[model samples]
Target: MGWLIFVWALTACTENPVDHDIRPPTTLEGEWLVTAINDEPLTTANGQAGSWLGFSAGAEVVRWEPGCAQLMFLYTVDSDDFRADAIRYNVPYDKPIFVPSKFMPPPCAIGWPPRLEEAMEAMSLARKIELTQSGSVLLSGEGRSITVRPR
Candidate 1:
């Protein structure tokens, strides 16, 4: 009886094998700096030029500032599915919305940065978020993708 009980206890105490095939979805609840656009590497110069995204999981909001303007989006995520709707701000045309009042150039002078335009277009088209093996986040859709890394 003692031997049988010891055998039973040993079997019961054995650890279950971990399932390496399954993994929890990656989270998108922190600040991320843009690293690439459509597979093209974004240089430090271009990244510094302004291209970053921050997500607030609690608030369900994502904020992106791309050089000339600040943009906000209300977002939702389920597993790998992700969606974002731009939050429009009613700006009174009388005020200057450009950053750094002194060094405003062509695009900024016009109140629209070309990079911002491209980013907005890509974001609007994005419908999925994927985690790369390298730990970067890829937001992609309609053949366009934006890769970002944790800040």
Candidate 2:
């Protein structure tokens, strides 16, 4: 009789299970490589947007890797919302340089927020992060989708 009551109480306690999935960062500092934006790769080669996105050409690929240095993006999290700002870090002479040509389409075409001054205005619009069952953190808003894998 006591065992049955204990089992019932245990089951009742679990009626509303707690979700311990997502947690904040202890150290969110350092540049996290934007591994993939939407479904397009941020790799050095083939820096164009995926065809499904229908973005026009002149899409520049920004690399944070050793050789080809483009844009070093900075990210910040406020509670659940986060923003990634593009910072033009001076590159070593040995590495490939990124020159902003006037005629080219803006960085936003390639899924980057924008440079410092403009990015500040852009960052003002906070976007929330959603955690998936597979443990991937999704940052999506304003017709943009990014899958961030912190490096």
Ten consecutive residues with minimal summed lDDT in candidate 1?
15-24
Across residues 1-151, which tens digit of lDDT does each residue of candidate 1 receive?
A: 9999999898666333222344424456777776667765554454553443432333476666543444566777776777767665553334333233333333333454345545555665778777665667677789987776777
lDDT of 2 at 134: 42
Please report, as a residue range, the 10-residue window in candidate 2 with the lowest summed lDDT. Answer: 51-60
Best by TM-score: 1
RMSD of each: 14.6, 13.9
Error of 1 at 147 (Å): 0.7
Q: lDDT of all the models against the reference?
A: 0.58, 0.42
lDDT of 2: 0.42
Candidate 1 regions with alpha-carbon error over 4 angstroms: 1-27, 45-59, 66-68, 90-114
Q: 1-151 in candidate 2: lDDT tens per residue? A: 9999999888666422222366633223433434345434444436552212111111222234332223444556666666654454443443322444443333444443322222222222337555544444556567565544444
